[model samples]
Target: MYVKFRKSSRVFLITVLFGMLMILSASAQTGAPINVRGSITDVAGEPLIGVNILLQGTSTGTVTDYDGNFELRVPADGVLEVSYIGYKPQTIPVNNRTSVLIVMQEDTEMLEELVVIGYGTVRKDDATGS
Candidate 1:
């Protein structure tokens, strides 16, 4: 005599197979890399184009576009630094982040003139009649 699986057993087996397929598909999609996008701007809220946005301690980097927008592929664990000439650099920590907005402040310095003489260097004030 051969033992037979009942109708409920057949239905349960089919359901399990379908569940496994769904799990595999979901895992595949989640394993794919994520694209990160963001914008960089100055304290004045103006977009800064041509700014260098790089992952800290890594060669992976991208430059801001004309609209101060940038896109990059960052790993699951990645941190980035956004920098531009004459602007204070900013470092951002990114982990599974999809988008970011950065605001950079300008470095302040006292504008002073310096004169280079044949013998030595001198400040503009020293050269002028005090």
Candidate 2:
């Protein structure tokens, strides 16, 4: 069997194959969704309640339970970003791990400042009454 493709036809065929290959490779890299379990704590080893656990580059996320434990289904290679109020956020790579532990550090600079609503910040000497 012999089949010949015209110049334009060949270009279109090649482009289609390239597009399929790209889609396949992207899906392969992302891999399958796996259950990941982890916990968040402070430097003192106390569970941090209501901590935010988000998948980097994606809107999928969850919050910690009262015990600071969280479970989420994410891509095998996805990265996890943990955050909490008054603490430094941490980014951890999944790397196919089934379990993870995160420790949040206090953001001292934030604790020392007074953030004014809508106004950003104002010095105590500036004087304000609302």
Candidate 3:
């Protein structure tokens, strides 16, 4: 008058239950994606175009438009790394902020190479004097 489950059936049931619990717990731990918007500018307060905007620790990234404005979807808590040529990179923390404005500073170091010859200054490649 009673039904009994075989060993394989019991093991399968336990495995299914465990998997469900794991999925539920994982869903509870991570948050939903949020819309994050931001803009990038230079010290002169001019919009910086084509800036690389990347989500920290992830391959997800975007680039600033012609107006240096970008909208990215990220977790409520996330970090953004903004970079451009000739400018110092900036790391910004989301912290649940929906909007952000950043000003990029110029890198003061110069990488130009020059050689002083007996006559005048020449490019590093053109210099053949010892």
Provide the TM-score for each candidate, comma-separated: 0.58, 0.71, 0.67
Q: What digit string (tens of lDDT, one per residue) describes model 3 on residues 33-76?
A: 78889889998899999999998999999999999999999887
Model 2 off-target regions past 4 Å?
1-24, 114-130
A best-first ranking of the candidates according to their TM-score comes to 2, 3, 1
For candidate 2, give the lDDT.
0.88
Model 2, span 6-121: residue lDDT tens: 77788899999999999999999877899999989999999999999999998999999999999999989999998886798889999999899999999977655544557466
Per-residue lDDT of 56 in model 3: 93
**Which residue pairs does candidate 1 place in steric collision?**
none
Using TM-score as the yardstick, the better of models 1 and 2 is 2
On TM-score, the leading prediction is: 2
lDDT of 1 by residue, 14-105 (tens): 99999999999987654445688999888789999999999888898999999999998876567888887667778897767889999978
Count of clashes in candidate 2: 0
Candidate 3: regions farther than 4 A off: 1-21, 110-130
Candidate 1: what lDDT?
0.81
Candidate 3 residue 12 Cα shift, in angstroms, is 9.6
Model 2 — which ten-residue stretch has the worst lDDT? Answer: 111-120
